[model samples]
Target: MLATYPIAATEQNWISVTLLNALRLALESLIQGNAAPDFVDAISEEYRDAFVKGPKFQTLYEKFVAKCGILTSQQCAQILDALLDQNNFPAVFIATTTCSSIKDALPEVHEAAKDLFKHAFDKLSDWKSPGSEHTIRATYHQLVDAHLSHGSCPFCGYEPIEADDPDLADPDLDHYLAVSRYPFAGVNLRNLTAMGVNCNRSYKGAQDILLNEHNQRVDCFDPYGNEQVALSLSGTTILSGAGEGPAWTLTFDPDVKSQNWRRIFRLETRLKSSVLEKHYKTWLKQCISYAQKNNIDIRNMDGALEAVGKFKTTCEFETFPTIARLKTSFFDLIEAALNDPVGGERMHNFLVKAA
Candidate 1:
């Protein structure tokens, strides 16, 4: 859910040049209706530099041409156009199965295409220049620093457990489209997002988060979106605000796509961890202290509730986002407790004991 930079200029230039050249070669074969032998020869000659320098391209080109044999000229053109225009090669490959023969060839063609994309990224000599390396590394740290400063994993809203020396290594750069599957997107700027290492390596790992069962594209909740549904606790009883709840849940929204995103990332389980609960309890204790220090009369339940609500509302925007969501949700439970006569007395007694 974090913001990411646009593709670096050098990376974009390399992809455009390499993919456009590869597509042109394929188009030539398609137009001529070249058989296997002719197709191989044509590609070998046209992409002599890439084929000779990167032997893997020969295999990729062969697989791609084999797959293309099943496609009509219009279909080939459409795929190429989509790649050029939107940088969404996977969508085209996954969605269009007009030729039954293409079904068996799809997986091979996909891998070859990914290899080609990765090869192209490697060809950009300037891509890993010292300055470029510094920039990328710095960007990763900056993103993590910002998240830590804000108090949550931007992707799942969990508190990030940072190392004492976070600068010694960068947090993982999650490929929104797993690089293992979509090699072409390995260096695509929009494909990279900074996330907690666990979220990257443990939770997501090579899973294609971009498509649904019908192979249609599913838009993820944009980390950079202007607004988002916050996480909250549910099933909390009015008598005891913190005990015996039905675990945490996101404030429900009707956006199925966002829901799918949450499912893929397992955000609910991640955010409701014991560590987060500890943090939430600590914050609640602090709230109680603040109320007592400020002379909020606990017996005046309405005023106390209002005061607590106001404090949480203010802190919701001030602290890290994970904490903010936790605070708001917890505050809702506290407010409910204070509003009930029996619960209010219990809550007052609880706060008094804690104080």
Candidate 2:
């Protein structure tokens, strides 16, 4: 959430498109009455035999045969004219992240082609076999080539990710739209993104992002957009009336995307427990110890202010592997709080006592 990591999906992400397109071709023809005999035989004529034959969709191909008989010509025509207008994926990203509902955003088309798409995309599970030629080896290599996993997860900058090459491995690809629900997006590149394992499986595990903890619908952030998570990292009076140092709170900024992100990942409460509350005192202790070794006096406002500046340099924003922006904001807030009359005296006292 601290940095902006941009990624764009293209049709050239062919490893993903190949399987999905086969389903699309079958369904489009099925809806046209006299459909091609399963997708296996149809796509072979249209595409390279290598692509169509590497992995077989035996279950779906048979299902297509059954669908042709179950639906009347009238029924097929009705579906064909509806919003399911494309032979292949639209390639457009989900327009809204907050809710499963949006015009032409794949939700409406779920039921119409639900089984068709779900089965086709379900082949993804098989694509994981390392030794199989049918595996999505090309897709994984493409992700590394695009550098989608080059840095910390953009979803939550709390975990570190390996910068792997094509030969090593690939980053965890999160189904941003949750292909389980919107299986039509199973192979859509925009719907898949690199996320840290913690954020992908731990915090956001099986939970839909479009809804809050209370299950209320909301808009979510585009993972690859200009969205930067804004968290308030500040030196705040502890208010516990017993603790001896300043405290920190990683509160979300008052914006729709921020609020949804916080709820979706439980960011504020999680960070408060994991980072801010857990580390606040230790950070203060370290700063005080560093100042003491350097003989930076902290019995008064001027001395406390000087030591604060020195502490800032020791843990510069770039140094934090997790929550770099949060620490940077903490520096700004600490400086501001130290400039205030009441806050300055309080910090000065705390610093002297800490020393």
Candidate 3:
């Protein structure tokens, strides 16, 4: 989860624009197996000239993308806009060259089009100001700030809790980029708007490493190109699945679902059925019902109580709509439990411990 949304650099410097175009071209050629005439036509004379004359284009392009280095929003937006044009449908093929695995994951995407790339490139180029350096930095900062605010983790709206370890504290902005990248793929903002930062970053990354292209079982979930079909909420526990099946059922590449399952939900160990009181029967009943229907086992009383506590602290009181509703539901459960002690103890012993 992120504390803020990310802003995109909608504009770019001339050299950066040039680099993006070169990468798109190279990627397109690699994906399509051959460059389309439209793609050939889309290359700007200036960029084309640079590529022919500059020996370092490939190295520079790779470095920029690898670092998630800043780019102007104008450049990104233009690149995306042009890529989405019907004339540029072929640009998707270029993705294959950029990421070899893309060939199998998104085979249906169209090839990279020349006019669209050229237009996007042109749009970016035109935005260049008198001071290229200052303009680029300003544009980059604006987009980054926007993303930091609006693109927070959907589940918690909490940026990954900064790690104390310097090695881990480094932020992974690209993990959040899933929201933007998907939309950029086909100009589908609807997809972007609906994305959850947790699913996009946490789940996707884990899945990518866990599975290979064929989606077989592995030690981790490789999130690179996986989909999130179901998100299960049990008390404070959040379980995600690739679809309707068990976490282990949907195998493709890494054990993506399982890896995420471990990361998002922690086993509660402090619970004991004996601690049940008449304060949370209703909520307990609901949890039990949900588990029964879903064929989930909650025999571990500690786990159950821990789950209840998790709900109270994380899901119920949080600010998200999902957590907001959970907060209300939990209140009712607590009230019902209080009215009926045995059921309440079974349902919310965690509350008793806190009191």
Candidate 4:
């Protein structure tokens, strides 16, 4: 979740928010006995009035009533206020109690409120921009350049999606708060971020970030915030053996953010399978291939290590490239082992013999 896909200022009032806010006006008007229309320039007050009194609004209202049993106009207004808060999105999400309450109030249907809120929000999906072919998801993709613009999805560092291709379907905009559980955050820019299909669908489906298993509040990483969790790697490389056992330890900070990150993304298990097990041998082979192709001298410890360094330089070992961080860290670990007199000597000897 990098800031590479920061929302543009004008997009704060994206179509999702605009339509929802119009719906908000209808709710308020239901309580105000024919309230004046707060329509955008393109929409007239007559059109707005007819809509609130129409069968479409009646259908949505019926849905909420069926789910919520008894939802008053005052209660609906409060829900709109929380969902339609444009200035501060976090106020709606950060509250541990918000999910349990609806529209500044909660009854038995607080949990059901998520569905009611999303049902209203999903109406925007059908909306077509006048004179344009852009769908709502595609519209946001154009505005924010999609989450994979930085190349790799930072959530797992597994896949780097290309957002520029129109033929390809757009990447999933992961509802960070999970619209299935949270009320009215379906279209909010801050609540929506991108991650790979595996990260979004397989791992973090319907998981609540703010509230833990016991329903307690916990801290978490902000998608656009500067805070980043560091991963510490500790493992040994078996120089020679038929044994498929090279133990690896990937540690994260004990703080809430790091722990929750690990918990939410299933990072520990994923890293073991995806990074250590899959790419460990692949990277080493790449270094050896690079050295042979360039005719680098691997006769001495310094020369052998230099070949490793040079190989890292030639390859795309940066965060934006897929598995770049994995390769970079692996090479660093190799160089550290080679520089030592004990493990380094054995590893260097193995490299020289292989070369």
Candidate 5:
């Protein structure tokens, strides 16, 4: 998971200008009680000339405006709110209108708005302010990096920032809400998340992970939230008093939203099984080695359990996370085995021979 940082004032100002201009024009038309075609013409000119400054499409703009003109004042206000708040405008618009044909018309308006913002952001050119060389994009990343405690990519917990490289590549800035679908959010600070390039660009191209109404709940595992999805080992297990045939598998909590998040990123497929297994094996070997070196009895459950805690404390915090929870769960399984008399004997013998 990732967290958004505060929007820089300059960037916020830049974004505000574009949004306020459009809102001002829309409001002007609403106040005048302009017909659909007239309202469309006024706003389209304001958008194209004042903001986008590109190819004109008067016909499409007329159609989009006509659709908007039919909406009640309350509905129009909701559209204004969407511009400012970056809420689900399409869903809201669709809910307001009974005509299914309006669906095709809305995208033109959204695309124009998206293009306008894209141009303004691109016009900032260097992503830097007047005096400083530090880019706004870099500043945004720095804030997010701090928010994430400078940790590895939250989704996979594998790709970390390359500190030694002079030209370090920052994490890909993913639009939490797809910019193609939710164009109004194209530059919304809250909607952007810094993640691994592969996770952002390849795995989660344009998927709408935030589509479910339940997901918008404050308690859900937001990338910005303090609570994280816990990871563990699954599949056949010998250490937890169950006979094992296959190697353990990595599993996330069965929370449906978490499952959806995992699905969105293809976490199970993308995260290498060998990498997790290696970390578990290494931690286990280190525990057995510590017992041998210090003359601590591996057969003693308390000593073995204490070692697990010590290992977790020593190794969990890192720039590149080594699937720490899954590793801890492996130790938990070992501790469970030690607690059961039959399992304890089996695990003790297994460790003794391995050590």
Candidate 6:
């Protein structure tokens, strides 16, 4: 699941107004050698066409820097930051109802893209020339708008995705956000990352919601209050909840579970419920007869444990590696507990000690 952040066009407007005002003041001060008394009034005209405004903004910036003679890129960035900070401007978010595509009219919302270029020019960091800087910052804003425009959860309405599933056939930016936000998803950092095109508009986001231990939304857990959700692992299964009744279950599927069981727990997978009914019926009958002759019920602890354990160690536990090995180990443990009295006692004691 991914963590969602909120940004609004109203926030963007605030930032825009502040940046324009600062640009006016900086340019006026450079030209006249004093702050213009009507600088604030001049900034009131909102310029929405970024492609045109970009060049106009550059002309004004050059006039100022040429006059001042010593502004650096880092200094310009600081100035931009300081000017915006004075107005307490927030990060911008495009409204969900505003546009059909991310690229449409985005410059009108985020004029700071041009200013970021000014800062880049002052920094001389990577961009060797002005044209490159403009192109790069423009692209940055485009990516930002694209990211924002498609933010609503793919599955659920309004709310953003909490996480992405690897099973998704069309994972995109949404999926990346979903995985990046997972609390304990370190393993996925490398394996599950998808390109922007691959994850976009892929899965319905809401269906991916993971329940907290109480089976409620984990986000409901107060970050600073009594109710809190914690992340942990039950053997190899990812567990999320406070336990009495977990808010959600994130157990591996059957194959994963069985493979881990066989390798780690050393239980039998072949003699699984359905398998015994289909092909191992005669072998089970023979075991039952052996138990009867020994004056023990096949269902008894001693008889069952030995039979299950023998199948696990001899048949499935020794094969495979990686995920398959993990499944085999988990099953082997179950078989051991059911097959031998000593194995059951030892397993119980080990669990008790671990707890």
Please name the candidate that would achieve the greatest lDDT relative to the true structure.
4
Clashing pairs in 2: 98-210, 98-218, 98-219, 98-220
The local distance difference test score of each candidate is 0.55, 0.56, 0.34, 0.60, 0.55, 0.31
lDDT of 3 by residue, 270-335 (tens): 011111122234444655555456554445555455444444443344433333333444444444
Model 4 steric clash pairs: 78-103, 79-103
lDDT of 6 by residue, 167-256 (tens): 333223222212222211111111122223312343323222223224332221111122211111124321123232112212333342
lDDT of 1 by residue, 39-133 (tens): 33554343344444546656666666676678777766655543443345334323342212111335655565666666654454223323344
Candidates 2 and 3: which is better by lDDT? 2
Number of backbone collisions per candidate: 2, 4, 68, 2, 2, 61
In model 2, where is the ten-residue run with the lowest total lDDT?
83-92
- Which stretch of 10 consecutive residues in model 5 shows the poorest summed lDDT? 94-103
Model 3 poorest ten-residue lDDT run: 267-276
The TM-score of predicted model 6 comes to: 0.22
Residue-level lDDT of model 5, residues 1-355, one tens digit each, is 4332334422433443445445556644654675433423444442344333444334434444554577666555555655654543224322232211111345555665566556444543344544555665666666656655656677777766433222787667676767666556666555566777777877778876554435332222445445566667655364544454226676665466466667677777665454554455676788777777766776666666666556556556534554555566666676676677766777766666656
RMSD of each: 6.2, 5.4, 14.4, 4.9, 6.4, 17.6
Query: Candidate 4 versus the native: TM-score?
Result: 0.75
Candidate 1 Cα outliers beyond 4 Å, as residue runs: 1-21, 28-86, 89-104, 119-152, 159-167, 211-219, 222-227, 233-247, 274-276, 295-303, 317-319, 341-343
Model 6 spans with C-alpha error above 4 angstroms: 1-192, 195-326, 339-355
Model 4 weakest lDDT span, ten residues long: 35-44
How do the residues 159-235 of candidate 4 rate in per-residue lDDT, one tens digit apiece?
65547457886667677876655555666666777667888888888888776667777766666655555555646
Please report how far candidate 2 places residue 195 from its true position, in Å.
2.1
What's the CA error at residue 23 for candidate 6, in Å? 14
**Candidate 3, superposed: residue stretches over 4 Å from native:** 1-54, 58-141, 147-157, 161-170, 175-353
